[model samples]
Target: MIGLIGGMSWESSAEYYRILNQGIRERHGQTASARCLLWSFDFAEIEELQHRGDWVSLEALMIDAARRLEAGGAEVLLICTNTMHKMADAVQSAVGVPLLHIADATAEAVKTANITRVGLLGTAFTMEQDFYKGRLARHHGLDVIIPDAADRSTIHRIIYEELVAGQALPASRDAYRAIIARLVDDGAEAIILGCTEIMLLVRPEDSAVPLFDTTALHANAAISMALAD
Candidate 1:
């Protein structure tokens, strides 16, 4: 069973749920669905703590969620949001099951494409902090770039104010396209849709370079782990 620690925003978590079950049916049969457990959090509460930099409280919440899933018979775990993965190591340590790191899955996909440099799009925490980017650099040997300060602010605003609320506006899409173009000009061979909700605003067609959707890759990786012998 796969344990999904989700609902940093239910918008992207919905995508995770859909992809996991869809992948299962594709691999097995029409009626087949993934055997998974979801421990969803209220975004309002989680976002409040995140903005306040209350990581200790957030880590406690994540650890509790992971333990509940593990106790509920989950064999493997996935933290569905890229930003919330700040607590990934702690959550994994508190659980007996394996927590499939999204950054690891994403880095594998990026490396598989033979790309050495990538642009990242996510919340301010994900783009500015060392946790996600450091892992990509130190563990995967990939060079990660992010949008400039103004562009970063725009991206972050759209995510919290629109995307998470299930709005995919054309203006937001246009802004992302422009930001991606800048990253490509800066020599990004590919772009990482580091935020799970990012795939909602921008698609491959929006970028000149390749776009690696972490949500899709992470969910697909979860399916593989669940079906592994």
Candidate 2:
């Protein structure tokens, strides 16, 4: 069984829960859902820890969550937030169950999409951090391209103070489109919506460049692994 360590932003976690259960019901020929042990954390604490760069303390929180899930009989763990994945290695190492790397899963999807250079749009911390980018390059041989400072700030603000709070405006969509255009000019064959909430803003239809939704790709990977023997 899988344990979902969610609630980094309840909005995206809701998506994970829905998509995972829906994928299970659709593929397994049952009205039942996938067996999951969930541990949801407080948003305020998570946000505070993130903003202060208190990643070590943050890892401890997730480690405790993983231990709870382990005791509850989960074989694997999935962290629902992309930004919080900055501490993925530390959390994975502390936990008893195997932690699935969402970025790696998305990178695998990018491989199937056959895109060599892909634009990455996510929280400022994620874009700035080497954890996600290093994994994508080392594990998949893909070049990860990120937005410039201004565009990065714009996208980051839109995600935390806006999208994650459940507000989706058209202006936010346009901002992402502009970023995608810049990425294309920079030689990006496609854009990876590295932030789960990003798909709600910019979609493939809005951009001339191909847009890969990280949430969908990650969900598909989890489903595939869960269904496999």
Candidate 3:
């Protein structure tokens, strides 16, 4: 069975849960969905841990979550948050089950697309943080690009104040479009919507370059892992 460690902002977890269940049922017959366990955490604790960069504390939280899932009969673990994947190593070490790395899954998809340079759009912390960039560079060998400082701040603000709060504005889409255009102009062959909520803001129709949704790619990876013998 699959285990979902979610609710790091819950909004994205909703996407993960829905996509996983829906995708499963669509592939299988009626009444078939992923046999799964879910453990949701308090967003406040998660947010604080992220804000302070307290990975030790964060690791403890994820390890505890993984242990509980393991006891609940889950043979695989999905953290359900790309940003929190910063603690992927510690979490994997703590759990007996395989913890699928979201970034790696997306990177695999990115490699298949044959894009040499990819632009990333996500929370400011994620784009600016070395953890995400380092993983993409080290694991995928693809050139990673991000918005300039000004656009990064704008995108970050929109993610926190608008997307997280479930607000969608045309101005937000326009801002993202501008960023994508610049990335394309700068030689980015494709763009990765690093945040799950980002797919809500920008669509392929709005983009001149190819777009990658980390959430969808991660969901597909989880499905493949779950269905594997």
Candidate 4:
């Protein structure tokens, strides 16, 4: 069974849940789906902790969640948010189940496409920090490109205000397309939908470059591991 630590935003986590089941059934034939244990948290509470810069308490909360999943018989663990993956190490250590890193999964997908440089779009924390990008550099030797300050601010704003809120504006989609065009012109071979919810807005057709949806890659990786020898 796979364990899911989700609800960083109910939207993203819900998509992960649907995709995981859909992919599993497709892979193993009719009625064959992943047996998953989902422990979804309150996004408001988690966001409050993040805004306060309380890493210790945040880690503790996630660790507790992972422990609960493991104790309840989940064999593998998944953190359903891109930004919250910063706490992955702590949670993995506290639980007996193997926790899959979303960045690793995305990196492998990028490498398979033979692309070394990609533009990334996500929350401000994910863009400014090394946790996700650093892991990609260290593990896959890929160069990640992010938007400029103004673009980052706009991207971050749209992600939280629009995407998380279950609203998709045509203007927001155009903004993302403009950013992707600039990134591709600046030599990015592809774009990484770094935030899970970002994929909810930006589709492959929106970019001249290929779009790598981390949520799909991560979910597919989990199903592969769950069924692997």
Candidate 5:
């Protein structure tokens, strides 16, 4: 069974749920669905803690969520949102189940595409911090590129003010397109929609290079693990 630690806004978690079930049905039959558990959080509360830089409290919450999912019979776990992956280590340590890191899943997809230099778009913390990018560099040996400071702020604000609220504005899409073009010009071979919510605003047609949507890849990976012998 797969356990999803989600509701980092409920919007992206919904995507995870849909993708997981769709994958199972595709591989099995129309009647088939994923055997999974979900420990959803109130994103408002999580958002407050995140913006306040209260990771200590956030870490505790994540650990508790992971433990609950493990106790609920989740053989493998996924933290549905990319930013929450900041506490992946803590959550994994607190649970008996293996936590499938989103960055690892994304890195694998990028490598499979034979892309070495990739652009990343995500929340400010995810783009600027070492947790996600460091994993890609250290474990996967991939070159991760991010937008400039101004673009980073624009991406971050849109994620919080709009994307998380289930809003995907055209202006935001255009902004992302421009940023993506800049990254491509900077020698990025592919782009990683590092934030789960990013897929809502950006698509393959919007980019000059391949777009790796982490949410889909992560959910698909969970299905593969669940169906593995």
Candidate 6:
């Protein structure tokens, strides 16, 4: 069984839930699905913690969630949001079950594709903080590229103001495509949709370089683990 810690904006969390269960149904026979445990948080409170730079408080909440899931018989834990993964290590340390790192899963996918340099687009914290990109580089030996200050701000704004609000405008899509084009010109072999909500605005069909949808990749990894004997 898998434990999902979600509700970071709820939109992308819904996608994670849907994709995980759908993968189960498709892989197994009809009416067959993996046993799962879920713990959702009030995203408003979590976001507040981020703005306040209160990681100590944030880590406490996550550790508590992990413990609850472990007690509920979850074999593994998955944090559905990319930004929240900044606390992943602490949560894993405090919990009994294994926590699947999203960046690790995406890096494995990138390795399979033989891509060494990739562009990333995610929330401001995910992009600016060393946690996500550093992990990809330190652990996976891949080069990570991000947009400049202005473009990074634009991408971050679109994620929160538009995508997380369940809005995907054509203008937002075009803006994202332009950003990806610049990254491709700068030698990006693939584009990592680092933000869980980013795949909603930009997709493989719209990009010249291959698009690594982190949400999809993470979901596949979880399903693979859950179904494996």
For model 3, the run of ten residues with the poorest summed lDDT: 159-168
Task: Write down the lDDT of every candidate, Cα atoms only.
Answer: 0.94, 0.84, 0.86, 0.90, 0.93, 0.91
Which pairs in model 3 have colliding backbones?
A: none
Order of candidate numbers by lDDT, starting with the best: 1, 5, 6, 4, 3, 2
Better of 4 and 5 by lDDT: 5
Off by over 4 Å in 1: none
Please report, as a residue range, the 10-residue window in candidate 4 with the lowest summed lDDT. Answer: 88-97
Q: Each candidate's TM vs. the true structure? A: 0.99, 0.95, 0.94, 0.97, 0.99, 0.97
Instruction: TM-score for candidate 1, please give it.
Output: 0.99
Supply candidate 5's per-residue lDDT for 166: 97
Candidate 5 structure quality by residue, lDDT tens digits, 66-183:
8888888889999999999999998888877799999998899889889899999999999999999999999999999999999999999999999999999999999999999999
Give the C-alpha miss distance for residue 64 in model 2, angstroms: 0.9
For residues 1-229, write the lDDT of model 6, one tens digit per residue: 9999988878888888888888988988778776888899998899889889999999999999999999999998999989989999999999877899999999999999999999998988998999999999999999999998999999988987888788999999999999999999999999999999887778788899899999999988999988784
Candidate 2 stretches greater than 4 Å from native:
none
The residue pairs in collision within model 2 are: none
Superior by TM-score: candidate 2 or candidate 6: 6
How many clashing residue pairs appear in each of the predictions shown? Answer: 0, 0, 0, 0, 0, 0
Minimum summed lDDT over a 10-residue window in model 2 is located at: 198-207
**What tens-digit string does per-residue lDDT give for candidate 2 at 102-148?**
99888877888788898888999889888887778888999998999
| Candidate 1 C-alpha error for residue 150, in Å | 0.7
- Give the TM-score comparing model 6 with the true structure, all chains together: 0.97
Give the number of the best model, judged by lDDT: 1
Better candidate number, 2 or 6, judged by lDDT: 6
